[model samples]
Target: MSGRKAQAARNDELILQAARAVFTADPGAPIAAVAERAGVGISALYRRYPSKEALLQKLCGDGLKLYIEVTERALAEEGDPWEAFAGYLRGIVDADTNSLTIKLAGTFQPTEELGHYAMRASALATEIHRRTVEAGVLRPDLTTADIALLLEQIASIRVGDERRISELRHRHLALMMDALRLPPARRELPGPAVTDEELSSRWWTGS
Candidate 1:
């Protein structure tokens, strides 16, 4: 990367760190305050982000990448297919409910870049589903689409309290997984389809 691009990346990182600190301290804090904390001019922040929603989207995407990394590692380490699936599910839920993640999920819009990231994540999720199904750990009827939908729903839940979010996610995930254990006879459910509108509405409430 060129010097300017590197500097821009550094600035973006600094701004993200500052935004997390300010938002964690006060979710309703002003963007100007974030810029102040980041030691950048408000104009500079705007030039980089264009809108608060854009900033939040970038932050959320970054958080999701981290989540994916952990999930991938767990899947590799855990020898049992079911255990790997469970680990991935829990990792995703934990990442989604993280304070920074939650704040971004509540505020960000689904941009093109975000959509690409989602697609990549969905592909990985599908692979996990396929592996589990082949191992007879997941119901043969359970499709990767279904798993993705369940994950999206879990990710969209917005409990402001971190502990409450974590507990609720765990409870829901357990219940959902139990339901996925189907009888041998009924083993072919269709995958759930996700629409752009549905995803955009879930995270971005803005008009």
Candidate 2:
């Protein structure tokens, strides 16, 4: 890419980051405030995002990408199925609470990019579910669909206070993990475990 284009992309990212911070502070804040926080001319902001909804959509997409990256890293570094599951759940809740992405995800109509990111996130959760189940750590009766629904429900939470939200998120994830424990007879499934690649392909590419 040309230097000008690269610079424009950088500026756009900065603006989105600023907008995220503002939204996290107050989801109902004004577009003018976001532009001001971004340190960009209002006209320039409009030129890039066109409207408040568009700017919010961009923020959601960017934030989802960041969340996915963190989850992937956590999964890669951990060995224990329980630890990996906890890390993934905690990451999602923390990301939703702090990232502007979750703030705007439900409020605005999503673009294709946002939808794709959501699919990938859901797939990751499914893979986590499959892993825990296969490892005899979770109930064999739990399907990937159930895990996806739980993740969606968790992501939908909206708390006005950041501290309270953080605490609640932690408690909720812990409870969810604890509830995954299975009895002796329901320890394992007959089928193969779900791989990350399989889950990603099934949900994201639909192949």
Candidate 3:
């Protein structure tokens, strides 16, 4: 790409990173806050996003894209199903996608494009869960929704800097993974598994 295009791309990435950090911390923050965090001129930010809602949509869309990539990669793996499942959970934790979900749900109206990405990501995740269960490793009663909520619960932990946060998340997630792999006769999770409808309703569109 040309110099101008490369610069524009870099600016876009910076704006996105700033927006994620800003809005994830405070969904009600003003658009100017993102520009300040990004160290970009407000005019330049508006030239790209135009509105805070627009930037929010992009952040959510990018998050769903990352989820899709992670799940799809896990689905394509040829190793043991349990290992694939564990790696998938680890990927989601490392990506920190659930933090965005925890902070941004219902904050912006979902567009059709975002809906498509969400569906694709959900389907891929469900397939991974199905394979793991069929292999008799994952708990039969656990649903994909449970895993999503579990990961989101982990993301809510904020003790220190990014490195410490990651260490804690992975540490806790490993314990949860072991629980998920326990013999069904020996352990049963309480409460009903969250349905996809319930999960989607957390968003503004309720789709």
- My TM-score estimates for the predictions, one after another, are 0.59, 0.62, 0.87
- Candidate 2 least-lDDT 10 residues: 184-193
Give all candidates' CA lDDT scores: 0.70, 0.69, 0.86
Residue lDDT tens for model 3, 46-106 = 9999899899999999989998999899888898888888789989998899999999999
Number of the top-ranking candidate, with lDDT as the measure: 3
Q: What is the C-alpha RMSD of each candidate to the true structure, in Å?
A: 10.2, 13.0, 9.2
lDDT string, candidate 1, 1-207, tens digits: 999999888888889988877875676788888899999889989989887777777776787577668657765865877777778788877766355644454554587877787777667767787788888867887777677678777755544355655666676677677777532233332233334654466566477
lDDT score for candidate 3 against the true structure = 0.86
Model 1 C-alpha lDDT versus the unseen true structure: 0.70
Which sections of candidate 3 miss by over 4 Å? 183-207
Residue runs of model 1 more than 4 Å from their true location after superposition? 1-44, 47-57, 97-116, 156-160, 182-207
Q: Which prediction has the highest TM-score against the true structure?
A: 3
- How high a TM-score does candidate 2 get? 0.62
Clashes of each: 3, 0, 0
